[model samples]
Structures are given as C-alpha cells and as structure tokens.
Target: MVIATGTLLLALPVASETGQPVKIVDALFTATSATCVTGLITVDTPTTYSLFGEIVIMALIQTGGLGFMTLSTLVALLLGKRITLKERLVMQEALNQLTVEGVVRLSRYVLFFTFLTEGLGALLLGLRFSRDMPPGQAFYFGVFHAVSAFCNAGFSLFSANLMDYRGDLLVNLVITALIILGGLGFSVVADVYTKRSWQRLSLHSKIVIRTTMWLIIIGTLMFLALEYTNSKSLAPLPLGEKVLASYFQAVTPRTAGFNTLNIGDLRPVTLLLIIILMFIGASPGSTGGGIKTSTFTTIAVAVWSIIQGKCDIEIFGRRLPRGTVLKALAVASVSLLLVVTVTGIMLVTEQEEMEIILFEVVSAFGTVGLSAGLTPQLTVAGKLLITATMYSGRVGPLTLAFAIAQRLGRQGIKHYPEEGVIIG
Candidate 1:
C-alpha cells in the first residue's frame, strides 16, 4: 500500500525534472526501490527527479526503512490512543520480536534511536558538505544522504554516487558508521545502550555482534587480497585509499549498498564473494535486508553441532531451542530457492550474461543495491521482476509465506513416524 501510494505520487508531473509525469513503469520501479530501502535505480536519481521528487523519494526511504508499523505506532502515541492487543500483536510481528512483552517500549526506543542517530549523522555530514557547496544546499545534501545511509537506503543526490568522494576520509567514515549502526538491529543497539556490558547482553545480541564483526573483517581482507592488484579497482590507488576502498566495499555488501569503488570492474571471484555477503545481509529488526545474520549464524551453528556429533546446538552458553534452529534452516532454504528461481527466470527472459543476471537478481533479493551497471538498461519485464524481488526481500520470504498461509487459513501440525532416508 505504501509503495502504491509512492508510485502514484511519483507519477505526478511535479515529481519530474521536465514538468511531466514519469512513465508508470519507471515510477513504480523507483517507488519499490525507495520504499524497500533498496538502492537499485532504473533512472539516475539526481538527473531524473526534481527537488520535489527527491524530497518524496527521501520520505519514502525513511518510511520504508523505519517500517510502516513503527511509524504507525508513533502516530498512535502522539494521538494519545491506547494500543490495543491487536496492534501490539502486529507490532510484535513487524519488529520481529519473540513476544509482545515490552513491544511498545521498544517502539519508543526505535523512534528515539532513529532520530538521534540520524541527527548526529546529518550534523557531521552537513559540516563536511558545507566545504564543497553553499550552506543551504550542503545542509539538504547532508540530511538526504544521512537518512539514506542510516536507513541503509543508498539513494544519492550525486550523479556519480559517492565515487568522487572515494578518497575523502570524513565522508567514508561518517557514511560507513551510519551504515553499520543501521544494520546492527535496533534491539541490539538498545541492549548495548542499557546494559553496556558484553556478558549481560542477550544470546541473540551476542551472536549478531560476533557474526557481523567476523563477516566485516573477513570481507575486508578478502576484498583487499583479490582486488589489491586489479588496475580497474584497487591497484591504481595509493595503499591507504586501497585499504579504505576495500573496507567501504566490504561493509556496503552487508545490505547498505553504498559503493566507493566501481562494482563492475571487480574480478569474478570478488563479485562472487560479494554475493555471499549480500546473501547473508543485515541482522533482524534492522533497517537493512537479507536472509539476516542471525539466520545465517543459526544455520552455521547447527551444522557445526552436527559435524561434532552433538545432540544440541549451543552458543554463548545457551542451547538454542529446536524451533529456533528449524526456523533458521527453513528461512535459509526458502531464501535460496527464491534467489535461484528469480535468477533462472531473469536468465531466460533477459539477454544478459549468466554472471550479470545472477548478480542483479541476488542484489534485488538481498536488497543490496550495488549493480554491475545493469539496472538502468533493464527491459520492462526485468524491471517488474526486480521490483517484486525487492518487496519480497524486504518483507522476508518466511514472513511472506506466513502471511499467505494465514490468508488461506492456518493448518494444524500433523506429525507422522519418521523413517530415515539414505545419507549423502
């Protein structure tokens, strides 16, 4: 519904640079990308959209990134209306909480954290941008990019999309810091804020923190090694810029989608590595999207336990519930199937190479907007396919399935005696 409304608004003549309504396909594509917080663009944002259009897009990105439920809750609070049980249930599902306990308080925290963080980012970025442009324009740019980065929505007002700022330390540091904070789920941030001790944090927070750190470290090292000598990417830069670019590229694939390096110029191996990182995306209850860090870590822990011939999956001194393990595996399986099916369809319908098509499809599915220069040239069918993927990725495969099942009426569990199948 939000995307539909955004589509209608963007299709207005007031939203375009030439005082004409954008084509329906283009409007819908842009709306989906912004509302899903995916940075993919069929039209160059700065060149195609007027100031009014840019403001609309930024609004959509903020609404999409913080999520519909979170905003609605804030509105309800402002209205002094009580949150009924039904609303609490909806909030629970929207925030990916395990229960309804403290959901309202959490919503308050979400709004507070979001505004405070975005404000700080905007101040820093605005001060930096003021050096390059007039104060008013600098402030606007700072606010737009700060919201975009904090929401993990990579939409940029600049035509080159931060490529010109690749060597600017302040820009890189501020943007990456916002991306990391946004990708680290709000619940984790709240936990850290309140507890301020690693040992006192919840098990989920521990796993998410550990997994995110390891992925960033590994991705940075791998990117540096693989693209270190590739002239098109990292080789021409001085050692410091190369390292900076490596870190930026590494972090962006975790569903932030801002790129300081040309994504198309990377080697096949480097691209494949990025695919893996995008697939495992941000943690749950965060602005970003993907299968999620918790999901990936749960699956890995389960596999490790099996390999060790252990009966239980244990992490951070707590044994995971059987249902948690099952849900994690289910999410991964469904995500893989969705990615494979979408990639296959694109390959059949589009004239692009296998690698390019696969990359685009994964980018859509992960809501990680880095493209191999394929987004703007997509055919109508390709655009529609990607739009649907962005929506699905943002909502999550399992959540979509659950919604469908509920619409069709819930089915009761029916268990039968198990018979072992042949082992691999």
Candidate 2:
C-alpha cells in the first residue's frame, strides 16, 4: 500500500525534473526499491527527480527502514491510543523480537534511536559538505545521504553514487558509521545502549558484534590486497585513501550499498567475496536485508557441530535452541531458492551474462543496491521481476514462512511419526 501510493505520487508530472510524467514501470521500480530499502534505481535520482519526489523516496526509505509497523505504533502512541495486545503481537513479529513483553517499549526505543542517530549523522555530514556546497545545498545533501546511509537505502543524489567521495575520509567515515549503526539492527543497538559492557551483552549481541567485526576486518584486508593492482579501482589512489576506500567497500556490502569503489571493475575474487558478504548481510531486525549474519552464523555453527559429532550447537557457553537452528536452515534455504529462481528467470529473459545476472539477483535478494551497471538496461518485465525479489528479500524468508505457518495452524495441528531418509 505504501509502495503503491509512492508509485502514484512519483508517476505524477510534478515529480520529474522536466515536469513530464514518469513511466509507470520506472516509478513502480523506484517505489519498490526505496520502500524495500533496496538502493537499485532505474533512473538517475538527482537529474530525474524533483525535490518533491526525493522527499517521497526518503519518506519511503525511512518507513521501510524502521518498518511501517514501528512508524504506525509511533503514531498510535503519540496519539495516546492504547496499544492493544494484537498490535503488540504484530510489532513483535515485525521487529522479530523474541517475546511479546516490552515490544512497545522496544518500538519506542527504535524510533527515538533512529531520529537521534540520523540527526547527529546529518549534522556531521552537513558540516563537511558545507565546505564544498552552499549552506542550504550542503545541508540538503547531508540530510539525504545521512538518511540514506542510516536506512541502508543507497539511493544517492549523485549519479555516480559516492564515487567522488572516494578520497574524502570525513564523508567516508560518517557514511560508513551510519551504515554500520543502521545495519547493526535496532535490537543490537538498543542492547548496547542499555548495557554498555562486553560481558553484560546477550549471546546474540556478542555473536553479532564479533561476526561483524571479523567480516569488516577480513573484508578490508582482502579488498586492499586484491584490488591493490587494479588501476580502475584502488591502485591510483593514495595509500591512505586506498585503505579508506577498501574499508568502505568491505563494509557497504553488508546490505549497505554506498560504494566508494567501482563494483564492476573488481576482480572475480573480490566480487565473489562481496557476494558472500552480501548474502550474509546485516544483523537481524536491521534496516538492511539479506539472510542475516545470525542465520549465516547459525548455519555455520550447525555444520561444524555435525562435523564434530556434537549433538547440540553450542555458542558462548550456551546451547542454542533447536527451533533457532531450524529457522536458520529455513531462512538460508528459502533465500538460496529465491536467488536461484530469480537468476533463472533473468537468464531466460535478459541478455546479460551469467555472472552479471547472478550478481544482480543476489543484490536484489540481499536488498543491496550495488549493481554491476545492468539496472538501466533491463526491460519492463525484468524490472518487475526484480521488484518482487526486492520485496521478498526485504520482508525476509522467515517472515513469509511464519505467515504461512500461521495459516496452516488455522487448518488444524497434526504431528506424524518421524521417518528416516538416506543422507549423503
């Protein structure tokens, strides 16, 4: 419904720079991308959109990033409406919280933290941008980029998408910080906010922080090493800038698509590394998408446990629930299926090669907007296919599965005897 309204508004003549009506296909695609917090754009945002349209896109990005449920709850609370049990349950599901208790309080924290972070981020960015742009223009750019980065919605006013800022440590650091904060998931942030010590953190929080740190460290090292000789990407830059660029490239694929490096020019090895990072995107309940770091970590631990002949998956001196393991498997399986299915469809319909198409499909599924430059040339049908993929990716596999599980529950609950099947 939000996407549809945004599409309609964007399709208006007032939304376009030339005062000409936007194409329905492009409008729908943009709406979906913005609302899904997927940064893929068919049209150049700054040149093609008016300020009105940009605002709408940003609004969609915020709504989608924090989630509509969170926003609606905010409104409800502001209006002094008592949040009912049903409303709390819906928010619990939306935020992927473990329990029904304190979900409203969590929602409140989510909203408050979102505004505070984005505001501070915008201020820092504005100060840096003012040196180059007029105060108003700089402020505008700052607010937009801050919101985009914080939402992990990679939509940029600049057509090159932060390429010009490759050497600017101020811009790079601020943007990347916003991305990391947003992608860390509200729950994790809140956990840290409430409990500032390492030992006091929940096991889930510990794993997320640890995995995130390792990924950024490893990714930075690998990118700096791999792209050091590639003139088109990192080679021509100064040593300091190269490291900064490498670090930005490493972190952005955790479902934040603000790229300082040219994604297309990277070697196959770097792209594969990025693809793995994108697939194992941000933490759960983050503004970002992908199967999530938790799901990836859970799967890895489960596999390792099997290899070690352990009956239980253990982490941080605690045994994980079996349901968590099952859900992780379900998420990974569904995500892989979606990516494969979309790639197959694009292969049949589009003219792009296998690697490029796979990249695009994974990008859409991961809700990461870093494209290999194939978005502009896709047909209307191809765009529609990607739009659906973006929606599914943003909503997530487990959410859809849970909805189905609810439907199945209504029919009747039944349990059957376990049956053995041959294994590899």
Candidate 3:
C-alpha cells in the first residue's frame, strides 16, 4: 500500500524536474526501490526529480525503513490510544520479535532511538558538509543523508553517491556508524542499551554483534588485500585512505549500500566476497534486509554440527532449538531459490554478463542497492523484475511463502513409516 501510494505520488508531473509525469514503469521502479529502501535507480535522483519528488522519496524511505506498523504505533501512542493485544501481536510480527510481550515498549524504544540517532548523525554530517556548501544546502544534505544512512537507504542527492567523500574521515565515520547501528537490528541495539554488558545480552544479540563485527573486520581486510594492487579501486589511494575506503566498502555491502569505493571497479574476487556479505545482510528488526546475519550464522553452525556428526547445533553455550535451525535453513533456501530463479530468468531476458546479472539479482534480493552501473540501462522488463525482487526482499521470502501456504489452508500431518532415502 505504501509503495502504491508512493508510485502514484512520484508519477505526478510535479515530481519531475521538467514538469512531466514520469513513466509508470520508472515511477513504479523508483517507488519500490525507495519503499524497499533499496538504492537502485532507473533515473538519476537529483537530476530527474524536483524538490517535491525528492521529499516524496525521503518520506517513503522513512516510512519503508521503519515498517509502516511502527509508524502507526507511534501515531497511536501520540493519540494516547492503548495498544490492544492484536496490535501488540502485529507489532511483534513487524519487529520480528519472538513474542508479543513488551513489544509496545520495544516500539517506544525503536522510535526514541531512531530519532535520537538520526538527529546526532544529522548534526555531525551537517557540520562536515557545511565546509563544502552553503549552510542551508549543507544542512539539507546532512539531514537527507543522515536519515538515508540511518535507514540504510542509499539515496543520495549527489550523483556520485558517497564516492566524492571517500577520503573524508568525518563523513566516513558518521555514515558508517549510522549504517552499522541501523543494520544491527533494533533488538540488538535495545539489548545493548538496556543490558550495557556483553554477558548480559541475549543470545540473539550476542550472535548478531559477533557476526556483524567479524564480517566487517574480515570483509575490510579481504577487500584491502584483494584490491591492494588493482589500479581501479583501492590501489591509487594512500595507505590510510585505502584502508578507509576498504572499510567503507566492507561496511556498505552488508545491506547499507553507501559506497565510498567504486563498486564496479573492484576485482572479481572482491565482488564475490561482497556478494556473500550482501546475501547475509543485516539482522532482523532492522532497516536493512537480506536472509539476515542470524540466519547465515545459524546455517553455518548447522553445517558444522553436521560435519562433526552432532545432532544438535550449539552456539554461545546453548543448544539451538530444532525449529530455529529449520527456520534458518528454510529462510536461506527460499532466499537462494529466489536469487537463482531471478538470475536465471534475467539471463534469458537481458544481455548483461552473468556476473553482473548475478550481482544485480543478489543486490535486489538483499535490498543492498549497490549496482554495477547497470540500473539505468535496464530494460522495462529488467526494471519490473528488479522492482518485484525489491518488494519480495523487503517483505521476506519466508513470510511470502507462509502467506501463500496459509491461503492454501492447513493440512494434517500423516504418520508414515520412516525410511532413509540416501545420503549425498
């Protein structure tokens, strides 16, 4: 519904710079990308859209990043309306919480943390941007980027994204911080905020934090090593700038999408590594999207358990539930199927290289938004395909599957004699 509304708004003549109604296909693509918080664009954002259009995009980003239910809950709170059990359950589902208990309270924390973090980010970015432009323009850029960064929506007023600010320490630090915080999942942030110690945090929080930290660290080092001598990417910069750029690149592919380095210029190995990171994107209940870090980690541990001939998957001193492991595998399987199916279809429909097509497909599925300069050149078929991919990524493949399954009605499980088929 939000995407539909945004599409209509963006299709208006006032939305374009030339006072012409944008093509329905382009408008739908932009609306889906914005609402999904995916940075893919069919047209140049700054050049194609007027202030009204930009504002509409920004609003969609905000609305999409934080799910609509969260915003509706905020409205209810402001109206002094009590959150009933049904609303709590909806909030639980929306926030990906395990239970409805304390979901309303969590909603409060989500809003508070969102505004507080974005405000500080805006202030810091505004200060840094003021040096490059007039105060008003700088402030506008700051606020826009801050919200975009915090929401993990990679929309930029500048055509080059953050490439121009690649070496600027302040911009890199502030934007990466916002991306990391936003990608951490609000539950993890809330856990850290309330617990204030690692030992006291929930297992989910612990896993997410550990997985995120290790990903960033390993991704940064690998990018630095692989692109160290590649003239197109990290090679031309000084050591410090190289590391900085590598770090920013590492951080962005985790569903953040703000690239300080040229994504298309990176080596194939680096791109493959980034594709892996993008596939295992931010945690649940966060602005960003993917199969999720937790799901990825769970799958990894499950594989380890299988290799070790263990029946149960254990992590962080606790055995994972059978259902939890199954769900993780289910989500990963569904996500992989989606990516593979889309890439296969695109290969037949479009003329892009296999690697480029795969990257675009994964980026769309992950909602990571980093394109290899192929977005603008995509055919109408490609655009619609990616638009659908973005929406599915945002809503989650498992959720979509479950919705379909529910509509098919419940089936009773039959007790059958168990037999082993074969082992691979």
Over the full model, what C-alpha lDDT does candidate 3 score relative to the true structure? 0.90
What is the Å distance of residue 227 in model 1 from its true position? Answer: 0.2
What tens-digit string does per-residue lDDT give for candidate 1 at 1-424? Answer: 9899999989999999989788999999999999999999999998889999999999999999999999999999999999999999999888888778999999999999999999989999999999999999998999999999999988999988899999999999999999999999999999999999999999989999999999999999999999999999999999999999999999998887889888999999999999999999999999988889998999999999999999999998999987677777777888889899988988878888888888888888888888998889899989999999999899876495345434444455896898999876
Q: Top model by lDDT, which number? A: 1
Clashing pairs in 1: none
Candidate 1 regions exceeding 4 Å error are 398-415
Per-candidate clashes come to 0, 0, 0
TM-score of 2: 0.96
What tens digits encode model 2's per-residue C-alpha lDDT throughout 1-424?
Answer: 9999999999999999999988999999999999999899999999988999999999999998999999999899999999999989998889888788999999999999999999999999899989988999988988999999999989998889999889998899899999999999889999998999988999899989998999999999999999999989888889999999999999999887888877889888888888888888898889999998888888999999999999999988989887778778888898999899999999988998888888888888888898988888898889999999999998868586566445543544676899999989
lDDT of 3 by residue, 149-212 (tens): 9898889999999999999999999999999999999999999989999889999999999999
Clash count, predicted structure 3? 0
- Weakest ten-residue segment in model 1 by summed lDDT: 401-410
TM-score of each: 0.97, 0.96, 0.97
